[model samples]
Target: MNPSASKIQNPETTVPKTPQMNERDFINDQLTTEKYMTNSYNIALNEASNQALYQDLATIFKETQDCQRNLYNLMFKNGWYAVEQAEQTKVQQTYQQFTGYKSQLPYSVQ
Candidate 1:
């Protein structure tokens, strides 16, 4: 086997050769790629629709969160009210003990 032929067959020893290509084909492919890619992909979406959808979703989420907060507030408020009521009841009992309801002398004294 010839050493020169063996060297040509080896990729490491061989020089890289440029292939012949058509300029028109290259330009066409570049133009096609540019046409497919756009600056804003979501430009097709309507502004009105986007706004309405976002508002609707935001309203639903806000309502759900507000409902949870209101429930917590109501629960705490009721607990506080119960405590206040119990304190008032204790005060009332003490007052009743001091100024006990009188039978007076009874109907016979009247």
Candidate 2:
């Protein structure tokens, strides 16, 4: 781990390590499924030609995305998921680097 990067997480809630799947394992599996569903839905939405089909998929996509976020939150709350806090200087540098590419785009960026 980088010295400047700190973990944003709660204390881990203990889980069983038996042959059977535990709560964390089930949630993690669901979270992974939701992520895959969302990605597939996005691609489908992009290629969908019929308006009705597109609308249906769009709704499902939104729901899947929300579920994915909820699962992530649950995992984070239980310390099953941990995110690294980006150093402000590194974040600023990345922002600047991406922003510098705005001028290279054909259309004007606001």
Candidate 3:
């Protein structure tokens, strides 16, 4: 009996399935940064239906020398709880960041 062959036949040991991605979805989620997100947002805005675009450069704009360096620790987390929390906070801060981002930002978004 081959242990490797037996292990390969077991489906229960596999990792959970990630969400499916179609052609457009793949391109849509390509970038994970607010800057690229904003640039993509810009291009998408021209093609999108809404009149104004809501995005910020906070993710890509690291004017601060050590910005987000503290949060990099999430990479060592166990089950992505840290990553999820980081994302939630990032979104909230990004929302708040973008709230005032307009005035401080380089260009107009709305």
Residues 1-110 of candidate 1: C-alpha lDDT, one tens digit per residue: 32333121212222224474444344345444433432122232223367777576556555545554554344344331122233555679988775554444466745
Q: What's the TM-score of each model vs. the native?
A: 0.24, 0.93, 0.19
Rank list by lDDT: 2, 1, 3
Give one digit per residue, the lDDT tens place, for model 3 in 1-110.
32322121212222345587643343224322433545554565456454333233332334321322322222223222122223455569888977886777666545
Q: Model 1 TM-score?
A: 0.24
- In candidate 1, list every pair of residues with a backbone clash: none
**Deviation (Å) of 60 in candidate 3:** 25
Candidate with best lDDT: 2
Segments of candidate 3 deviating more than 4 angstroms: 1-83, 87-90, 105-109
lDDT for model 2 comes to 0.96
Which model, 2 or 3, shows the larger TM-score?
A: 2
**Model 3: which ten-residue window has the lowest total lDDT?**
5-14
lDDT of 3 at 14: 26
Question: By lDDT, is 1 or 2 better?
Answer: 2
Give the whole-model CA lDDT for all candidates, comma-separated: 0.43, 0.96, 0.39
